[model samples]
Target: METILFFIIVGIISTIFGKSKRTQGQSPKKPIKVSGMEDIRTLFKELKNEVSLPAAPIKSEQKVEVLQKSNRTLEQEYNQVRKESESSRKALAASRLQREKMKEQTIEVSKDECEPSISMEPNAQTLVNGIIWAEILGEPRSKKPYFPKRG
Candidate 1:
């Protein structure tokens, strides 16, 4: 509550001060200009005038020779890299093809390895006999035929 009252009092005082500053006829404040900017630019221009670095001697024929040699070397390196990249791409493609072929071969082998589990159709008598093992064993016998019978 004290903080609220304090803020309200401050707001009223600030509003009065702001209105006085805004409404009272007063002369405009002059803009402050930074000094030394022109001097710095004059110094820079003088330096640019004083310093005369002659261009490095570049004979037209030598320039052509260096450029030609560098171009040839760059072209050769580019060709080598392109050749290597091409070979790597071919190798990757071949490896992927081999991977696909191996997968297909594995599927084919698995299919060949798997055989049919039973004769075409189990007879009615065989099916009934298979289930009767539970009654014969007497102690809730379960899937005894499914468990291979001992000789």
Candidate 2:
């Protein structure tokens, strides 16, 4: 382990010294040449003239046509969405009315069934009362008294 560590330290030192020697022995490089102010001014003038040429008018006309087409499509989409929402609203109202009618019918049916029970004859009422008591007491029907068979 000690031998391996010694070789690693030696290798790092040799690389560091080698890079410093190579940089110190090299000559400095010359500065790069650049264009003067007149050349820059002429280039800027050419660019400005190209930007202000006939192609600008054609681009503006095309932009206008594109904007009109997009506006028409947006208007059509808005009208379609409005129609769909109106239809959904009508459907919702119809379902609400149907639910209310169903509730009224159920109420009427329950009331009719209750009226018959209230107006039942004495013998039938007594038999019903006995059956209800037997159910409450958990009595089996086989142990109950037999009734006359109905025609």
The lDDT values for all models are 0.84, 0.85
* Predicted structure 1: clash tally: 0
Which pairs clash in the backbone of model 2? none
lDDT of prediction 1: 0.84
Q: How high a TM-score does candidate 2 get? A: 0.43
Which 10 consecutive residues of model 2 have the lowest summed lDDT?
26-35
Residue lDDT tens for model 1, 69-138: 9999999999999999999999999999999999999999899889646677899987897688656766
- Residue 52 of model 2: what lDDT? 78
- lDDT per residue as tens, model 2, 1-151: 9999999999999999988987887534644336656788889999999987855466778889999999999999999999999999999999999999999999999899888554455787688988988888887766675985678
Off by over 4 Å in 1: 1-54, 117-151
